[model samples]
Target: MNKEYTVTDDEVGTRLDVFLSNQPDNPSRSSIQKMITDGAVSVNGQTKRANYKLRLSDNIVMTYQPLQEIEVQPENIPLDILYEDKDIIVINKARGMMVHPATGVYTGTLVNALLYHCHGELSGINGKIRPGIVHRLDKDTSGVMVVAKNDFAHNSLAEQIGSKTAIKEYVALVHGNITEEKGIINANIGRHPVDRKKMAVVTSGGKSATTVFHVLERFKNCTYVKCRLLTGRTHQIRVHMAYIGHPLIGDPKYCNSKNKFNIEGQALHSLNLTLNHPRTNQQMTFTAPIPQDMQNLLNYFRQTI
Candidate 1:
């Protein structure tokens, strides 16, 4: 394919690859660099490096071949399906299940299973890599999630979540003694300045995040709580809880405490999800049973107390 772009005054001084990345349906930056290196991209009819800076009214032409599609293979992994219809599928996802494939993880994910089950019925708006995935739960956060079967459902669900009309509730066991029955942790979350991989509660240069938590039970040292997110920032619950001196029992990124409970991952689970049906506009709620690990831990705490 071939296209021509005339640089505008507002876009001056941007790198060649950066400019291409902003284009709709453009290839990855690395791919753009490759195209530039192969003389596929020319500025004013002359080839230039990927780092070439744009100038006002500069005429640029680019030619490239689309990368071949590599389909994600479907796996016959059994899913704990909660509800299924032509429009959506609700599942009680297990802990350790990646919602979609990531770098170096191409199989054994929820996407692969969804591919097999839905059989090409998944929505294509997110592309092949993340077909049907509406929102995601972290790998260790097991619980209720919905997958879209078509584009209409996908758009509706995405809008509801973005507008804060969709309600998602969670259960977690954290290390703390809560005197208050209910509380709200409102903070801004951003990437940790030191550790790029972890999210943190930052005072500035962060997105506003809020978590409303209700104390369900208090152990001698630990507490069981229910949390509802008012804003869906990355690791919002974990970061906010740790900021308030309570971290999920097995959270690897935020908490640095001992794992005496023998929990495999963070003691957090998506307990409830409520949203309106995309087609009927009727309210619907889905629930997932707590994983046995967390349930057993709670039972033991209650029995011993």
Candidate 2:
């Protein structure tokens, strides 16, 4: 049996999942979403996605179900540490290493490595297994990611990122020689109209996304560009790069298959992150070197050009 929650003025306009997270005894937001998916939770007596906005007097009824506990086993994985402290750990995750576990890919992830390295000190965010994850990089996009070690740090880092107080920059090797020294890509990113698996810039009901890019170097058929994300949307950089007619090199999903060079995935790397420490109130900046694969591609380009 689950408890019923009546919405109040303070809870009005709050996302359903967020309201559920405020409850101490209820399962995590993701857990509640699973329950809703399984027809266990009802909003105004009807099922809805976890993101449904609550009104001042809506009825939220939930049937509580025990969630399966996740035992994160530590695997001896090598990590490229850029910086570490009692509150946070920044790592240069190698390409192809998923940030966290998913349906078919459980274990042997960055979370597993962090668990092993940090000795199980991680803060649970929204009740998913990603205890310390503040942001994410693509599976093939290697870069610097900061992981929180405790609740205070987790909350602070997440809030900083959400508020755009944290500065993040990426270096990418995109095809085509962009003549402009700097440019901005502004679009609404949403699920592809026909292909739900991919993202596209559309005029429909989509979130506003912006990316500022600067050309670092020019090649005969490619340009090395640096991107700063003003809004973090799924595949924002890749989608923006493609939308500008200069898809990333070796990007199978967005790039043209008739590419001249041989590479794999987008050559995007999260090179730098800067933010204020949650507990210390001291400004901190971290940088990670470009991964070997991206470096190799750049080296090849410099030689041929």
Candidate 3:
């Protein structure tokens, strides 16, 4: 189906791709750009680049092609469930586990396990692929996460996180010894202009992000620190830590190859999470013990230091 939109006066000067992404249809910018380049999108009856500037009253037409949804199946994967109730379930997500299914990854995700455990009672607000998922932990970052069982609970929990009322804390071992006892990184984050796959501390056209860290222990060349996120931007902690020159140990994406530790992934863990109960409105906190790999690395550091 082809859809048409007239650029409003207020929408003038916006990039063609940006305007399309902000629409209610919510297509990803990459998809929109791809469509534009393929001539699936046209402005003023002519094909335009994704970065073409829009003007008032410009007529834009887009071809709307729905993506084929992949079916997610239930899997009997074991879960370290911390807490469960009528409305929510909290889990200590393991490392190397994805929170939800993506293209080319349909099984062995947290969602697949939730589907089996919840028995189709999980909330569908996030659609089929992310049923009951309220928040996410990166695949390599093991930690605590809460899932909503119903729509009401999902809305409540999402509100708490979006409003910054929910608190999330992490423990990480970084490459360099942090000199400061405690510090805050207040920077704007955006997709890296050169490497679109990575996030960076951007100076312009970025969203505000803040992370506070306190040094827990310092080794000869590494520091164990606790970090609290004030904003939930993608890779916020990793980007902020790397920006400050103390990338997390074993962080393959952000850190250089100078890491001496033979670890599979970043030495970061979601140590604690605090939020209000959706049903009772009572404050609740959950903590997950550090994974064995991180602990072993820490022990090695201790012996060496």
Candidate 4:
């Protein structure tokens, strides 16, 4: 569908991509840039770059072809739902489960399960691929996660995370003993220039990321720590810990060597989540118990350390 807008006085001087992203459609900046590059968007009847500054009363027309809807089939995959209400559902997402389906992955995801559980109530803000997913945990990271049932709840929850009002805490077992009881890592993170599959602490052209950690227990060759995310970036906790010489135990991508522990993936868990209720405005918190694999590893540390 095609949409047109005249830049107003208040919108003058905004980047073209930024201005388009703020529209009601809420297209991603990357998507907007792609549209501009493909000549699907124009300012004053001429194509403009994503960084072009807007001028008041400038006519902007965007021709967006709606994505072909891929049917996200409902799966009866069991979910360990922790909390549920009319607006949202909190689940203790198990390890080894993808949050949503992507290309080449169409089933056995949290979204598929939610489709069955919520029964068509999931919000469509994230498109058909990631319906109701306000945020995500890694595939191997077991944790508490919340899903919105409606667009209103989805918007509110997304705002909370964007504004850093939602609190997310994790517990991780890393490969080295952390000396400090508590500390903060302030660094910029972005995609690795050489390795596109991984994230790294880049010196420039990266987003600012902050992670706070407190040592919970120190083992012979590992540290159990609690991490709070001040800014949510992809692989933020894992990258920050690795930058501090304590890459998470069993982390295949970040850690250089195989872990002594027989765990399949990184020993990281989203232990707690806190946020304000979207509808009621009441503060709420949810917690997930440590999974058995991590728990057994911790017990091993307890007996040996």
* Candidate 2 Cα misplacement greater than 4 A, ranges: 1-70, 258-262
Question: Residue 64 error for model 2, in Å?
Answer: 21
The worst-scoring run of ten residues by lDDT in candidate 1 lies at 62-71
The candidate that achieves the highest lDDT relative to the unseen native structure: 4
lDDT scores of the candidates, listed in order: 0.89, 0.84, 0.89, 0.90
lDDT of 2 by residue, 31-87 (tens): 567777788879889988888899988998887533335555787899999988899
Best by TM-score: 3
Candidate 2 pairs with clashing backbones: none
- Please state the error at residue 22 of candidate 4 in Å: 31
| Deviating ranges (above 4 Å) for candidate 4 | 1-69
In model 4, where is the ten-residue run with the lowest total lDDT? 22-31
Candidate 3 has its poorest 10 consecutive residues by lDDT at 63-72
**Residue ranges of candidate 3 with Cα displaced over 4 Å:** 1-68
What's the TM for model 2? Answer: 0.76
Model 4 per-residue lDDT tens digits across residues 194-248: 5556789999999999999999999998899999999999999999999999999
Q: How close is candidate 4 to the true structure, as a TM-score?
A: 0.78
Candidate 2, after superposition: displacement of residue 127 in Å? Answer: 2.8
Backbone clash pairs for candidate 3 read none
